[model samples]
Target: MSSSKLARMAHVCVLALAALSWGAKTVTYDFNVTWVTANPDGLLERKVVGINGQWPLPVIEVDKGDRLVVNVHNGLGDRGCSIHFHGMFQNGTNEMDGPSMVTQCPILPGSSMTYNFTVNQNGTYWYHCHTDYCYPDGYRQALIVHDSDAYFAHDYDEEFTITVSDWYHELVEDLSTEFMSLYNPTGAEPIPSSFLLNDTINTSIPVKPNSTYLFRLINHGAFVGQYFYIEDHSFEIVEIDGVYTEPTEADMLYISVAQRYAILLKTKDTIDKNYAIVTVADSTLLDKIPSDLQLNNTNWLEYNKNAPHPQAIVNVSDSTDLHPYDDLSLVPYDHMPLLPEPDLEINVTVYMKNLMTGYNYAFLNNITYTAPKVPTLYTVMSSGDLADNPEIYGDFTHSVVLNHNDVVQLVLNNGDTGSHPFHLHGHQFQVIDRSPPYGPGFYDYLNGDPVPYDPNNHTAFPRTPARRDTVVLPPHGYFVIRFVADNPGVWVFHCHIDWHLSSGLAMLMIEAPRQIQERVTIPQEHYDVCRAAGVAFEGNAAANTKDFLDLSGQRSQPGWIPDGFTVHGIVALAFSVLSAICGILSIVIYGMADVKNKQDSVVPLDNPNEVVVEQNATGQTKT
Candidate 1:
């Protein structure tokens, strides 16, 4: 071949390789979570956990195939925190999946930890602290992952993320204790004082005439489901829970807690006319909300920015507040073409009862889920007891282990008096079917028995099923969901309502434990996290491992900054997983990879106020 012809062929090969590998962007964020007082609704000053000193935290926006690396520095005094990225299928990076006491120990106070994961998929999601009642204290943020494969491009010119939440006057710290106490008589969850759009009672969205805008909506509330609509605009739903569905139109929609929707708003020629954005609390499920509190709110969708903001012209109606819409009509763009018959089925019954201590709580399978004293991941890995002896974890932990590659089906039969919004981490599942509140509310039993969630029935579900990470389980009803046990790690399947979660209405899906133990190597930094949090990993069984990590030499004392400030300490460790998809930038981490036993290490500091222990680079630690 001639020299020129050889060079041209080489150029063509380089171009082809470039086309094969393009979208691999790594996104980095520095988030500092601290306790501050902010009145989002402008009514009362309540202490809230804010990210980077902002109440609603920051909206995370990124394109698909981007790596998400977040440094969560918890500055809350004496409060341990963990954040769960709501619906990410944390493939192969289960350590980055943040569910406190499930995946890893809580990030200790005055300590920073890095969460590195990849967003290979696209959709609307949210991030919130998964520990205790921190989310109700305003530790939530909207996460949007964009892609080029959107089918609704023709209907929208631009996009906006709007969050609707139920706002309360009192701090969650003040109310959660009473709500879960044994002495509480009323047994009613605390009600919200107001409802907010984008963290404000009055939200004004300016729009142009003859333009289409995609409004990415998120229900970031804790207690109540919301029904929202504009007075004059009829929007078409294009996506639900980060999955695009075939375009469907509705006058009003009810969104459950932690649910997301992408609606295309087609602006009309009603020039200079302002429409009311009616937001009302659908309290039909709850029998008790403080009568004095207001539940109806009015936001604005204005065509003219100069027009004075108008009050709500439409009535706060309960038209679509009956129940969540049927997912059978909504078609998911990409998913398993046909629902598979489950290899394993679980009948999870939700109950309401007073415990032995007289505290009212919601129960799954007659047992309320409790936070494990140890991070279940470490427990499973170190002891190898999850598969052999799950009974050791007991009923409170509710850790269910499944073998690899089993198709799992869950039947949620609601035995409680109120509805719940259930969410699963890791993967989205197909909503197989649901029963009406008494056989479609007709004389249907006259024809046959009210058949609901029977495993023997084959024709119960629609041919095509709805795929989502969250679904509303109505009271006195049932819901069926199916998913494959592919991701090998511990994932949370729980109620998204903050109150219910605090009340122990949550369980763990320890998928493919044997495979997880064989393929996945628990990093030393994860054990260091438990060491910093003073949580014991190996409980009953003896294991061959170093007790603690002694990095280098000992330093004199501990140091901490107050109120949203960053801290560098022995627990300030970062790790990097070098995979083909993305990489983590590990900055100034000492004793992260190497493991050694600490001679005089005390039990992990349960109190953040404990004396600061320091370690030098010589593998020696000192207090």
Candidate 2:
């Protein structure tokens, strides 16, 4: 039997086993996170983070109600790791949310951390390493929560989890150094070397002639968003970011990083020909497109073994030329109405600025997020009555305290020129309003200043708004989202672009802190891992156990550059001026000395037309 066939049989067996238990049961995965080499793009072989010594880490599958226990042993010897189950509500299990220094310390090399949580949600989701640019190294894969009870489950004959990613020839560590350097003053994101489908180039998925197939498409890349489509075929969008949407027909979709979509594609009735599955990377997001880099990748739907599989003929002058269906127009399948007037509104504008070090950093308003010395969740668990105080989490963490069950509205204004896909942990929020809707006009704001959302002067919001964990904030535009703060945990709201995220484009929402204190408990293994990693398990952001308010030695982002002149800037300027003066003085002295030597050596000539030549330095004389 072929390895692919055996793999399919194994997947079926797991699904059958999961189905056998109607009631909720535990699904355990023992992952030994290690380094493995792979050349997915065929251009270069590089080290990647894999599970159980396997590249393209295993896809975690479980039923909707099953409890998932991922016991991760960080065998990557050189790096720390943590797993964030993207789009999981996590509810009372905030520690399991898995952002290092936010919920728990990183599972350091040679340490173990078990993520034990209930899979209460359904639809497509993913799991990835949330520690310091780790997922880009290949520590991510689709995490499917099987729902036999889905509304459209009976509509599709079969399903496939397809992942589209932007590939890089270099590792993240090297790229990060170049990205966060003085050379990258504008914070131009590194362009990808290639785009991939199912982690490889030119792959094919065999299909039946006239079958309805559910394709769970995930953009698990680090930086670029991708426009996805199938030639001569259109798909019905059924879900976005795990939220079931009313089936809307779309010929193409623009899936940003960390975003997901579930589409029902009906195959062509005739099996004589094959169709190309095309994914075009959003070239507008890149600062420069390398001549050698491929912006588009084509896989296929193989209907016949002998049919000619041809490459897709891309006609777009730019990726934006291909219009994608606006996700903001999608209505949730549940038809959940917008919540009542928000009890609290948090308005933040995204900014990109160079700090004192002259390296560009991303920010929310005037603050850039910096991880605290102690994990924010640990601080919440440790601070007796001060858990509700955002100060305990430190100033640089950009912490916001929220009342339990209060309707929270978040207005995100993009001050930067680039579009950012913002993702929220713990809850899927309703996208209430956005300007310059997702089409040809999406880039309209690039010609002028950013347009902030005006609550009173905007189009009426959808009665039943789209609810998703991730939404793209248009370039130089704004978006408003609302959700009930019912999930008590320290959830992060941040841009999904890994580069931006690494540069501090994130903030923590401490929702129902008092409830979090009462509901959540740190597992002993987590504490053990903290000890093994030499991280503080109980304390404030500064690790001060005595006084939560005294955040004296907490981690902080680099201070902003002051107007006019800073002391360091002035000193640097003075040094530069002095060096210039010295260089000029040396040149002048040499030129004057040369002139004097020539004048001293010259003898009077007998005739006016005659000239005297003399050599002095080498002790040679001429007349």
Candidate 3:
């Protein structure tokens, strides 16, 4: 072999050694937070949390049923903190719901909480700080809960845990506090200077030719929605929210905040080719926009800078030498059983309007931010009232009407200046379309009609159709989702961001249809009281009449009503017949008048008297 070939081999050998050391063991671990300066190499210095002095805490992999403990030691001297596990259902037990003060008390400074919960699920999941006012860069980690059979299921030749985060060179605390204190803020809160995909300050993924690799992807960015994909080659989605599906394929997958996805990919055999996984701004994901920005027609980038979008590329080396291991960690979907499906569709749209300020604004369809009311206004007010008012100045987001048994085709259309992760209450949806003309914030600039119809290009996310609680809709693009109206009751659907939902991005979905509601029996005393009080039993007349007849029938025969109620039925029939006759006579009279007018009109002029004016050379007209 030549010297250059030997050098290349040596370089690859060094990388292999690094990966081996990195991949040696996967176990559950705890981390204590420590404050560190962000933009250590950036122009604007900012502060963030470091895990045991590392920027990112190590990936934790634990088996199912294993009791996991996460001791989050709050190192920041000024702020209290807690961790919220995204997408983990712990039997509705509030003990595991790590809200800073509501579900559980905050872990104050110099203190920590040992959050214990069973690893009941097996898919992509994440953990992050739930403390308010902490910026997006404060603290977060990826927690991969492996299935019980994960070890013996498939032997992956190569596996990578690639995480994408939005990092800025500014203090999150200061930014969030400042924005909240503003009388009327315009655009989004400021973002950090850089975006990191897989720990690279600014880099892409490099792939070995003809080799496959498993990528366990996570989106822990505080608020931004991300799109994860591999250019050219498709990504086979194996799991989402830490649940395995029947291995679905897609060109790209969008990940909302607090959501995770795992994918398998095999690099192309051809040499010198590069594939890119990108996150552009997604307008479909935003809650609402300001009116002034809309007036000025602000572009997506000018409004929101740190949209959680990061991209990596797999580069194929063109040398004659090719890697022998063609298999990536992605297990082949050889003989998987078919899976069940969802039953409805919920359509979502992300739009923005310019507020009359120097700053721009956003909304998830129609919801915006607000402070939690004292005595909890939601306790006394109706759900409808809470949905109509905005605690902040943003657009409407929860503008959906759903009825039970209505199989939904939830389509999310991005009409805003930025991207948003459109999440639902009780289900996940199939992604049906994504067209391109990517805007500045990594949002897709695709068109869509208002109706809940699926576009043709996009495919379903893996394990999604099973019962997704959340799905990300790219900006400027629309997503088509189908779910069953299974859960009856008032459910909330909105952006997954705690602040966004708290603002006004949430609304209630009453699943009771008209017919089902009519079955509710009213007390006779209450009905009599309503009648005496002049309550018009307008819409309920049909049911009231039917009940009256049934009571009369019960007093008489099984097949006939009593003589007393029979006269009422006859009177109603006579009124109906008379009304029909009157309507018909009215129509006949109108028709006759139209015909008479047509007959009485004079003959139309074949040609009116034509007047011709000829202009002479001296500007004189001759007719």
Candidate 4:
């Protein structure tokens, strides 16, 4: 090829590539949250919340750094709804966070709200309703953000997601009634009638021989942790939550509630043989149902159904009898233990007992948490009372107010008999340390103050800790995590198990309340939803207090007008800021549109060595 021809080809390729990647900006999604009754596991039928009328909701996929705008219209008959983006760090847009009673008000019945945030991190994630105890229903769905810099980048042929869960037949309302009643006051959670994968008992996945595939496993269950394994296939895990990890080869993995794992699967040369992709409820920590009630959920991995296979091909087992590793013990790829020197440390010991409520309630920091009448976010921002006097903030809600950009080290010790899967919203925390299962371990527990344990203990600190959003706290074991409170919001750090969260195993992280107030403008739509919820609860007088706290008559301050500022003056100033923001956004959008519309004449690729060749591309030969 001549020099001029080669130069022209390169120029054309760049132009075409630029054209193809144009207009790839933030995505906006409109979702309808409606109550759709369906049987997902074929065990029983009941009303379950569905997104866009689809059971198990729908998978939301995006790229890293894309601004996500999701508008949700709640159509549940008498309940409120809030969709918490499970692993997203809402950063500056704290009001857009959806944790009810923690961040913002829930979208009331027949109401709509918009969640806008930038997906700055990437990997397997999920979203679900955070209001009430309806998380066990079919409301949760997978949310995946693709990152180009993900570990094991060039090793995979294709990628897919698998969601596994325990299925219940009764609605949350009915279950809560029995669960909290005197008959079952010890709060023995209802055993699942079945287990499911992607809303089905058995899901099918097609595979090609000798190819590398990425399988992202999302454990979206509300109660039980799941054990996952593929028959005769060993895989390498590269990512957990939203952070990539050093590749760890394993045969089986333990996936707890609200957790995710990304692994690379290499297919064997056997073509016509089918393999089992099995997921069972971790029987060690959950109620065991009969073997016939669809307990062991499974999927299939095979190459071709039509082609006949030789007898030499190995067979797979349908029995769920594999031992899964403790995933909390894994390490991150960039493992350096000394990275997180915390500015503040908080120690909590999880305990469950029959408390103020008739049911068995879980506690953290010796406080059985309860949602306040006003949202912690609203309470902190509107009045700045929590910031001015944080001493008054220490109530049943168990709040830990942090300064702006404060590095925090949180230690959790599970004092309960059962294991708990804990998850934190708005941040992916670096896991620094954990205690051994049942032995004389590193931490000197005998010499310490129990219950509200001592936080200043340097006991088995890691140099290169694994970072994830959700972590498992083994029974009588401890786990420590470090995170920086850079994002200002009322974030929820709670046990991911629905029963525990509903039973008050949660704490509020009031991060930089004053900074959040200064940065985020409280939208009028949020105020509308708050008013509507109170009104709906008052009129019917039948809705549970846990659903929405009654905010009638006990008025603290009227209107959010600041001192020395008139209502009209505040409105005028707000409108001016809104107008400026709209103008800037319009300019940005128009500029992007103009770039997309720009026409460029391109010289064709007329010779060999000019075509773009990728490893997976077809029609390859020596020219």
Model 1 residue 285 lDDT score: 46
Q: Which candidate number has the best lDDT?
A: 2
Write the residue-wise lDDT of candidate 4 on 473-528 in tens digits: 76666888889888887788999889889888898888887887788776778778
Task: Report the alpha-carbon TM-score of model 1 versus the true structure.
Answer: 0.80
Provide TM-scores for the models: 0.80, 0.89, 0.52, 0.77
The TM-score leader among the candidates is: 2
> Tens-digit lDDT track for model 3 on 311-371?
4432322111112111111232332222344354455566543332212234545434221
Q: What lDDT does the true structure give each of the candidates? A: 0.74, 0.91, 0.48, 0.74
Of the two candidates 3 and 4, the one with more favorable TM-score, higher being better, is: 4
lDDT of 2 by residue, 1-623 (tens): 99999999999999997786568889999999999999998889999998999989899999998999999999999989999999999988998999999999999889988899998889999999999988998988999998888899999999999999988888899999999986667788888888888888999999998899999999999999999999999999999999888899999999999999999999988988999999899888998988998887889989996899999999999887889999999999999998899999999999998887778899999888898988899998989898877888898999999999999999999999999999999999999999879998999997799999988799998899999999999999999999999999999999999999999999999999999989998999999988998999888999999888898998889976779875456446656877999999999999999999989866767898986776778899876
* Candidate closer to the true structure by lDDT (higher is better), 3 or 4: 4
Runs in model 4 lying further than 4 Å from the true structure: 1-24, 306-322, 334-337, 385-388, 392-394, 437-459, 535-623
Go through the candidates in order and give the C-alpha RMSD of each one to the true structure. Answer: 18.4, 9.5, 23.9, 27.3
Candidate 4, which ten residues in sequence have the lowest lDDT sum?
536-545
Clashes of each: 9, 0, 78, 7
Candidate 1, after superposition: displacement of residue 247 in Å? Answer: 1.3
